[model samples]
Structures are given as C-alpha cells and as structure tokens.
Target: MRYHACRIAVSLSLALPLAGCATGVKSQLEVRPWHSINEFRDQRFADVADPWEGFNLGMYRFNYYLDKYLLIPVVNGYEFVTPTFVQHRVSGIFNNLGEVRNLTNSLLQLKGGESATTLGRFLTNTIIGLGGMFDPATRFGLDRHDQDFGKTLGYWGAGSGPYLVLPFFGPSSVRDTGGLAVDTGITYGIYTALDPFADTGHSFAISAGVASLEAVDMRHQQSFRYYESGYPFEYYMVRFLYHEKREIETGKAPTAN
Candidate 1:
C-alpha cells in the first residue's frame, strides 16, 4: 500500500505540472483576481521544506541504474537498430502527444462543430492515427490548447481557493488539485495496455526514461544552476518555467513574478 501510494504521489507530481499548467492558464484567463490561487500557493510555500538532499540522493541512485542498465544497453541497441538517428525517438513521440493535447484543448475551447469533429478526428488519429505511435495535431496547423475542470470551474467564476504542496505531488492550487481527480477520471484509454501489468510497467518505464533524459539535458543546459541552488529549488524552477511556458502557449495570464 505504501509503495502504491508513493507511486501515485510521484505520478501525480509529474502529471500535475504537465496537465496543471494548461488548466491553470485557462483559469487565469477566464477568472479575475488571479492572486487568489497564487496567494494560497504562497502561504503553502512558507511551510514547504526544501527536500533537495533527498531528491538529489534519489536522482543519483536512479541515474546510476539508468547508466548501468537502460542507457548502456538499450540506447546502444537502438543505435544499431537506427544508426542514422542520434537521439531517441521517444522524445519526438512525446512531443507529438503534446501537440495533440494542444490541439484538443484549442478545439474544446472553440466549441464549434467543426472543431469538435476535428477533436474527435485528432483523438482517433492519436490513438489509431499514427500507428498509435505519434500524434500530428500541431503538424496539421492547429494551435495547441489545454483545459481541465479546474479551468472550467474558473471559467464559470469559481475561486481558486488555496495553494498546497502535496507530499509527493509538489505544488498545486487547492482548486486545481480537486480538478485533477476529475481529469484523471474522465481521461480514458490512457491505460489500456494489452497486459494486465502493462500500464504499470509502461508508467515506470516512461518515468525512468523521462528522468534520465532530463538529467542528461539538465547536465548540459543548467549544470551551473543545479550546482548553485541545489535540487529542490531546481525542481521548483523547472515546474515554474514549465507552467509559465504553458501560459504563454495558451495566451493566458501567468502567475505574477
């Protein structure tokens, strides 16, 4: 039970940043006095203890395993399989999924029959469109967008309530956290792998793969910053930057700096 809870926490933590930003941006745009959520989040920040040491330890352990097992063996295997490509195709695939998500959100906000039809089409395409391997919504000239019940509630004029950093889930506004449960429930076909354990296995693999890729990229892009501020700050910065970027993409107001 503890292990399951930890996994759930970690999964929610990673997912919240990706999905939360879009919803949060939508909420900011549709609502007023946006500081309500920010204020709540800020208050929680006071209670937030830095966990850089623990995160660093975990990263170190995970990276060692990745280097010794996954990267050394599988990455090399991929090179032999696709010698022309220097980077893994997984990144491209994930990017394509992002494009699909953006397109879906844009269409949803428009609320037009044509857009609705396209949403269905794109969903189909992503699920069965690119051999179920890639999503091409962005490539088709549609702008990316995102929405969630939290954003929907804000659009309907609900308050953002408070900000909270869940033990494993990191940063979230109280309203947004509530919406996460709804989003998870409504999102279907996301875990429909063939094997009973396939979803679990896939989730773990993707998490580890993304972490490894991030570590390598961060080593090159922000090694100095990582060394200077330590891991917790680095993690928060990453989340902040990610949310800010999503706001920019969706044409929504960002949290005040």
Candidate 2:
C-alpha cells in the first residue's frame, strides 16, 4: 500500500501542474488546481504572466474591428478636411503640449538638463512657434525630448506586471498603462486651465476634442498593421519588443539572451 501511494503522489504532482496552462503566453509554471477560478485568472503562473489571454484576444479582435471600421475612417476624414500645412501645425501643437508631461517625467528621472530643455521647448514653441503650430525650438539646438511616466516608473525599478493588449492602444504592460493615465490627466488639466473658454464645460469639451485628434494623429504615425508580421508568434514578438523598449527607456540593458 505504501509503495502504490508514493507512485500515485508522484504522478499527481507532475500532472496537476500541466492541467492549467495559459492560452498563449506559454508559461512554464502551471496553475495550481487547489486555487479558486478567480485566482487562476489573475495570478501569474507562467513566463509571460498573461493570465487573461482569452480576454485579451477578444479585446484585440474588437480593437481591430474598431480600427478598421471607425478609427481609420475618422482619421482619413480628418486628413481630407485639413490641408497638409494645417495638419502639420496640428501635429506640432500636440507635440508642444506633450512637453509638459515630458518635463515632469524628466524631473522624475533626475535628468536636469532634459527637464530644462523640455521647458525651453515649451516656452519657445508657445511664443515664437505661435502656440506650437510650428517647431522653432527644433530649428535651433533644443530638440523635442519625449518622456513619459511609464519610463519614470521603470527607472525606479517597478516591474512590468503583465502584457496587455489595450483596445485601440495595442501592446502595453500594466506599468505603462497606469503611466498613460497619469500623463493624460496631467495634460487634460493643463489644457483645460489654459483654454480660452470661460466655461469649464466648454474648455473640457475643447480639450477632449483636441485629445481625440491627437490620438488619431499618433495612431497614424505608426504604419504597422495587425497580423502583418508574417509570423505565427506575432503577439509574442510584440510583447518581447515592448518590454525591450521599456528596458532601454529605463536605462536597463537587456541581456544577450
């Protein structure tokens, strides 16, 4: 009886771990069967730590459809309505506004020189560039410095919790997503406060429209299309590249592996 019991225990130990695997993240660790269903859904038990792969896949499909039917059409309409010069000016204005977030993040990362430069860019563009409709700062020596709260968090040693496929935003990790929220809120507040509209509601409405236009412009800046990678492991590849980018931004050198 003792010999049979030992054999059975060994079998269960090996088999149990293999019973619950991630849908696509290919985690080496298996979900513990003893845990509740909710635990498995949220717990990180694998290499990629994407416990919500099924939900992510569904969101990805939804985003793709939204992009195909809605976002792209709206962006194209924006392009058609505006002349190239106006579009460039709009892009510049958005870039100029983004400097506030960059400045704050630069200070957080302790890059005093970059923070100074970001402030310079903002002031110069707002004045000479005609409220950021042009980029006179770049014509001189001060180039645009792009920083974000996400990079700040990574610089401080916060691990990217898990890979996520955000609707319309594409690949992002938990840390970066939170960073995006903070940055957006900061910018929205700044714009609303500075908006010429006396009414808070009108200022908010204007800022929200500008923010939507900025999002469309930003999306159009990237040319990559879904499933165009020509490989079966496209999702895995995006997750790897994104993490690598975050690592570089945070001054972490990626291993040769």
Candidate 3:
C-alpha cells in the first residue's frame, strides 16, 4: 500500500502539470486552409515532423471529449464551490510556486538575469505575498518569466523533431516530451522534499491535494474551450501554432502578434 500510494502520488503530480501547460494556448499561426473536421487524419502534416498524425488526431478527438465531459465539468464545479477571490489567490500561489522551476531552467540556459528575476519574484511573493497566496511581486514590477526544460533544450539548439498528442496531456513535441519528464521528476522531488512523511498514503493525499488545486486553478484561468474555435483546420492550426510558439519561446523566432 505504501509503495503504491507513493507511486500514485508521484504519477498524479506529474500528470497534473499536463493540464496547466496543455490548455490556454493561443494560436500563433495565421490559420489557413479548410480541411474537414472529419478529414482523413492518416497522413502527417507535410511541413512539420508529425509522423504520427493518425494517432495524434485520434488523441486530439479523445481530449476534446474528455474536456467536454470531464475536465470542464470539474472546473465548473470548482468555480461554483469556490469564491472568485479565493480562486485568484490559489492561482497566484501556483504561479509563485512555478518560479522555482523557472529559476532552475533559467540557470541551465545561462540566463543569469532571468534566473535572478525568478529568485526575486519567488522571494517577494513568498514573503510579502503571504506564501504566494497573493502576487505582490508583479505589482512590484517583477513579473514571472515562463521557463521549462523544453525551453532549456531549445536554447542548446535541440530540434523539436515531431509533434505528439500525449494521452491526457494534449499537444507536445519529441523534445518537449523529454523536457516534461525531466521537469516532472524535479517537481516530484521537490514535493517529496518539502512534505516529508512516514505514511505513504498520507503523503499521496497531500500531493493529490496540491496537484488538484493547481489543476483546477489552471483550468479556471483558461478562456479557451475545446473545439469552440470555429476553424475547420483547427487541428493543423494548433499544430502550427504550437511549433511556432515553441520557436518564439526559445528566442529563435519572433512572437506572432
């Protein structure tokens, strides 16, 4: 039981981040073409490295149903039960906690300034923002910088390779998948370190609670809905945008508007 609980907790913690990073994506691509939503998804996109288009589109369809039936419903319930102010505080805490990750990746990229900024934001929020239950750092002119192992890989010239739609994780690339594993492992290590425990079941529960809070808060922050964008080439558009966004993120390209 102890071992199982430990495994479950770590897995959940890792899986929960999928929600936060997967959604709330804005299209960085000027969408073109008008493929049927039910168009044959067998062949991969010609330009990108998505060799598994059939599998990816199937997963995309699955994620749409999952979001509509399960994820959105749960987020709706969370919004109904929690006050807006409380929700805001929860989001702040999650963002502040993410500064730790940003800091680590920034250092790996040799971005001394970004690393310093992340540390400053973390300190300000934790101290003045009441353990990041508020975001006083932003008001103090220290906004958070998004960083990850994926961006770290890109910094060192790692190509994205191919697109993939991971089950329950939505869109990612081959390089980004590797980044996710390293990032998740580090995050799990931190959670265990901060919340040391004897009872593995209890530890799992604690991890679940934190992960759940982050997931719900992330969902509430998103304005996008699955399949709501009335674009016929939505799948291809998202694929394009994701890759474009990655390039912009790694400073290899400029932001699209």
TM-score of 1: 0.39
lDDT of 1 by residue, 1-257 (tens): 11123433564466447444655576557644323323545632233333343553355446545545654455455445653432334444444444444344444456575456456545654665452244454456544344555555455455555443443233455555776666555433343432235556586677566656644432322222222332233444444443333233334534558
> What's the TM-score of each model vs. the native?
0.39, 0.75, 0.79
Give candidate 2's error at residue 61 in angstroms: 1.8
* Best-first order by lDDT: 3, 2, 1
Clashing pairs in 1: 40-163, 102-145, 125-129
> Candidates 1 and 2: which is better by lDDT?
2
- For TM-score, candidate 1 versus 3, the one ahead is 3
Across 1-257, the per-residue lDDT of candidate 2 in tens digits comes to 01123433453354334423343344665645343334334322224657677877787778778888998888889889889999888888878877889999999999999999999999999999999998989988998777999889988998888888888887777998999898888876876577666666676677667668888887666666665544434454455556555666676745566
CA lDDT, every prediction?
0.45, 0.73, 0.77
Winning candidate number (lDDT): 3
User: What is the full ranking by TM-score, best candidate first?
Assistant: 3, 2, 1
What is the Cα-based TM-score of model 2?
Answer: 0.75
